[model samples]
Target: MILPETTTVAADEWVSQHRYLRDSGLRFFDLLVAVDLGDQVTEVVTHVMSADATRRAMSRIEVRREERIPSLVEVFPAAAWHEREAHDENGVEFAGNGDLRVLITAADPPPLQRSAALEPRVDKAWPGLYEPGAVSGATRRRRPKPVPGVNEEWINGGRQ
Candidate 1:
């Protein structure tokens, strides 16, 4: 049975901590991802397992927008793609990866970042809100609130 173990490490200690975990037992790299905590910090987490898959570990490093955590590509080559995706989605930089190309959309602010606006929700009308000429004499009740994650100022040609 593989029990999950988690450790939160400082950004500067990220690479070293992963190396320590690898030396201890977790040798098989599983995956890496980023989570936006909405506190101006992005939590980057990587999961790994022992060679026999009997042990598992998860390492987390929190970094602010301006900070770049050291890349683990040297220790786990599979981390390169995951790092690129994280960078593309959340704008988290991996210092040594060297190939942090945009793996997804090329939006100015990363889409998954908390500060990034959800333009589609603002630009398009919610399907449930209106159906033109579908219902006869169905008087509207009230103004619908903007969709979640969309600013009220950008709704109904409110703001650009």
Candidate 2:
């Protein structure tokens, strides 16, 4: 029933406060869910259930880009897989989780940011330094080889 400020709490604080939930008769960590916001933010939802109705409750958290929050796997063993899924799919970092890798194992990148993939990749266009002809203020010269069969005399024939 405690709602922390900013929807995210320090890992240590969270674990300490919820330690009792472990022994509160909740046998299962139901799921770790996430909602994707196009601009690189996701809302995370963690669900837990107790065999007794009075203790059953849900916890919500938010994960943002460039932020690392603690994972609940230590408090709820069942959260291991859920944390992994959140990390893989939504790019949420579960700070304390030892393993951080894609769950699906496909070569494709995460689906969270589809627009980035569709955008053109222009960085590889130039290998190293810019070529003279490729940019302004660049000059180019071409030299033609002499012809073997026709002598200068024949070519200049009548004129000279």
Candidate 3:
């Protein structure tokens, strides 16, 4: 079924309302995907199957990046994988999910968004003694200068 576009259902209600479709032989929980709108909100889409081979049903749910949405794992345990993928890729939250941290790595940054500076500064200054290619004998090797004191060390470390 095509759900209401703007309707917001309680987490439990959302799952309960769809349980019948599952029991009616809609055994496939195809995918759950989200699109990032560059703000705190995302558009989530859930696809399911019907008994008829050619028929399909989609239930869409909008979720804020900060807030949690209903988890479909209770109805279709297969949904857990899709839920985790949505959470990882688009930063969607699935409330009462069995494993919120699954399929996510600590090194992965949060979802991308527009801001004052979208690109990073590529030309930052650093102190090092090295030439573009090879230094000639006439060109004396630049002495390795100590970075002023501990303050410079701390600043560079923080940037990294």
In terms of lDDT, the best-performing candidate is 1
User: Roughly what TM-score does model 1 have, to 2 decimal places?
Assistant: 0.76
Model 3, span 61-117: residue lDDT tens: 666667888888889898888888877766677887878674764324443322112
Candidate 2: regions farther than 4 A off: 1-12, 52-55, 105-109, 113-160
Better of 1 and 2 by TM-score: 1
* Model 1 Cα lDDT, one tens digit per residue, 1-160: 5547678898778888888888998889999989998768999999998888878899888898898899999988889999999999999888999998878787878989977767676667555556456576686666566566554555543343
Give per-residue lDDT, candidate 1, residue 55: 83
Q: Locate the minimum summed-lDDT window of 10 residues in model 1.
A: 151-160
Ranking by lDDT: 1, 3, 2
lDDT of each: 0.82, 0.59, 0.62
Better of 1 and 2 by lDDT: 1
Q: How far is candidate 3 from the true structure (C-alpha RMSD, Å)?
A: 11.3
- For model 3, the stretches where C-alpha displacement exceeds 4 angstroms are 1-12, 102-104, 107-109, 112-160
RMSD of each: 4.7, 19.0, 11.3
Once fitted onto the true fold, the runs of candidate 1 whose alpha carbons sit more than 4 angstroms away are: 1-3, 124-160
**Quality of model 2 by C-alpha lDDT:** 0.59
